[model samples]
Target: MKRRHFIGAAVASAAALGAPMLRAQGRPRVVVVGGGAGGATVARYLAKDSAGALDVVLVEPNVVYSSCFFSNLTLADLRSPESLEHGYDRLGAFGITLVHDRATGVDRARREVTLGAGGVLAYDKLVLAPGIDFVPGSVTGWSEADDEIFPHAYRGGAQVALLRAQLGAMRPGGTFALVAPPNPYRCPPGPYERVSMVACLLSRINPTAKVLVLDPKPSFSKQALFEDGWARHYPGVVEWIGPDAGGAAVEVRPGVGEIVVAGAVLRVDVANIIPAQKAGAIADAAGLTEGGWVPVEPLALATKADPAVHVLGDAAAQGDMPKSGFSANSQAKVVANAIRAELTGSRAFPPRYANTCWSAIAPGDGVKVGATYSAGEGKIAAGAGFISQAGEAAELRAATYAESFAWYDAISEDIFG
Candidate 1:
C-alpha cells in the first residue's frame, strides 16, 4: 500500500524516559547494535524514512564491515577484497549517530545500553543484530586459540585473506581440508560454496592439489547441483565425505597439521575448521537468548524476553528463514516499519519476508535456493520457493553468477545508503 507517505502526528507520544541528557533531546531514539547487514539497513531506513522524526544511533565496533556472502569469491580470486569492505560514513549522511563502540550490556528494565568505551545510550527501542559467535567445545581438540594454525575463514575480512595466503603458499599436490559445521548455522550453503570456490582456484594453480570436504551432515543444500558441477569442472581433484563415511567424528592436530577421522589420521597442508556457532555474546549477556539464540516474535522480530528489544539476523531464532544477509536485510525493513509506526504514528503494513541464497559453484557457474515467508501462529512459515536444478544449461548458470554480482551491488547500496 501507500506506506511511504508518513502522516504527520504528535512526536511526544514516541518519547521514552531516559537520562536527563537524553530526555533533553526531546525525540524518540532507536539504538541499533551491530552495524552489519540488518543493523545498517534498519538504522538507515528508520532515520531516512522517519524524516527527522526519530533519533537513531548505530553502535558498531568496526568502522568498515566486510560481507560474508561474497567473501568466498574473494578467496577464489574472483572478487577483490576491497569490494567487500564498506564504511559507515554514508550511513551518517542520513543523520544517524554512528557509535563506533561495542555494546557490552543491555539494561532492559531501564532501557539503557552500556558501551565498551565507557558510555551509555538510552533508547526507546533497541535492535540487536550482532551476528554470530563460535560455540565453545563444539569440535574436539580444537578451539579459537588454534585459529591461526587452522583458520576458519567463515567471516569476511582478514581471515579470508589469511586463508588465501596459506593456500598460495601450500606445496603443490598438498591436500586442503575443510571441516564443515553442523546444522542451524548461518548460511546453509556457505561451507559447500566455499569448497567449490577453493576447488576453482586450486584447479587452475595447483592442478594436483586435493580438495577435501568433511561434512558433519549427511547432505547439504543444492547437493545434487554442487556434485554435478564438481564432477564436471574439477573431477579427480575434489572429494566429499559425509557422516556416513565417518565425516562427523574428527579431530584436528594443530601441532602436527593432521586430522584424525574415524580413528584414521590424515596429514593436511591447510585446514579450514568451521565450528558450531551461536548468537553474538552480547545476546547472552543481555539475557535475551534461550538455547544460545534470541527467540523472537516473527511479526516484528521483537524478542520474547522484552518486546522493546528486537533481535535480527544470525542472532535471532526466527523460524523458516535461513540466516543470510538477504534474510537479515528483509527482516530489517519489516522491523523499521513496525518501529516507526509504534514510535512515530506512521503507517503499519503487513510484514512479509523473503530470502535468496546464491552460490557460485565454479567460475561463471552459480546455483540458488530461495523462499518467501509469512508470520505464523508461533513461528515464521515458509511459502513458495525455488532451487537450481541438477541439469541446468551452461548459459543459465553463467547468468545466475552474473545476477549474484548485481544483487551484491544493490544490497550494498540499500544497506549503506
Candidate 2:
C-alpha cells in the first residue's frame, strides 16, 4: 500500500553441520519447504541432532520472516514490525542449507522436489510447512482488483507494511473494518486482537474513529479475554458482529470496498479480510489432502496419506490445534525427532502436539490458552488441554501471557538461530 516496503538485510550463511560429521549424506536427505516456524524448527532439529549425518535443505522464498504470533499486537502498534522480523542466518549456522527459491511441484514417486529454478531436489523424506493461502471467493467483494485498498496481511513482510501505512494515514473520525474469516482458520483469536490493537493505536490520535469486526463465526478463540480487555480499554471504540448479528457476509465487492451480509451493506475506509484456507500448493500437489488440509499421523505429522512425506504448520490437518506459530514450532520439533529415530536406526515413537495461542488486546495486557495433546484414532484429540474457557485473572492474564512474547523468541531461536 505504501509504494513499497523495505526488505530486510540479507544474512550471511553460517554452516551449522557438515556431511562427514553427520554421517547422513548417503543415509537419506530430508528437504523442508517453507522457512516459517515449522520448517525452520524441523530443519534445525534434524541438522542439529543428526550431527551432520542427514542432508537438510530449507526452501523458502524469503530470507527474513515475520511471525504471525504477535501480529495482532503489531497491528495495534504496541510492537514495531521490526520486533517480528527474523532471517535464516541462524539456520545456515546450524548447517542447514538455506535456499531462496519458490517451490514449483513435487515428483512424489520420484522423490524429487521441483523448484522454480527448474532444478529438482531429491529427498528421501519431504516435510512441508509452506503454510496457508487465502481462497479469493470467500469474501464476496474481495479480488485482485481490491489488493491496493485492503490487504489480508496474514502473511509477512510488505503486507504488514501496507496495513500499517493505511492505519497511519487514516483521518480522524474514520472507520476501520476487519473482515474475519470462517472458523478453523489461522490464528483463531488473531482477527479480534488485530482490531483491538488498531483501536488502541487510534484511541490516542483519532479518538473518535471506530474499529468494527465482521466475524464469520459465532465464537472464536480466547473470546472472553478479548472482550474483557476491549470493554475496559476500548469500550465504544470497538464493536463486533458475530454470525447472529449478520457478521457472516455472503459476498464481497472489491471495486466499492463493500461487504454484504444478510442483505445488509457496509463500506469502510480500511478492510482486512482472511478467507478459508488449505495447505500451500506444494502440499496439495504431493497428495497431502483428505479434504482441504493435509491429514497426518498425530505424533510425527507424517502424511497419513503418504508415509514418506510430513506436513507441519497451518498446512497440516491438525484439527484440534489452532494453526499458530507456536503449534507449528512444537509440531516440527516432534517431526524432527521422529525423522531422526527412523533414519538414525532408532525408533522415535509416535507423536502428539503441544500448542498454545496467545493474544494481546492491548500493550501489557494478554490472554492465552494452551494444551498437551495425544494421538487419537484418526486425529489428535484434547488430552490435557483446555478446549475453551472464560474468566480473566489480571495476574495469570498478565504474567503468563507475557510469556507469549517469549514463545516467539524461543521458536525463532530454535528454528533459524
Which candidate should be chosen as best, given lDDT against the real structure? 1
lDDT of each: 0.89, 0.76
Candidate 1 is scored at a TM of: 0.94
**Which RMSD does model 2 reach against the true structure?**
6.1
Shift of residue 196 alpha carbon in model 1, Å? 0.4
- What clash count goes with each model? 0, 19
Q: What TM-score, over all chains together, does every model reach?
A: 0.94, 0.90
lDDT of 2: 0.76
Candidate 2 lDDT by residue in tens digits, 312-378: 8899886587788878888888899989888877658567678887777777677777898777877
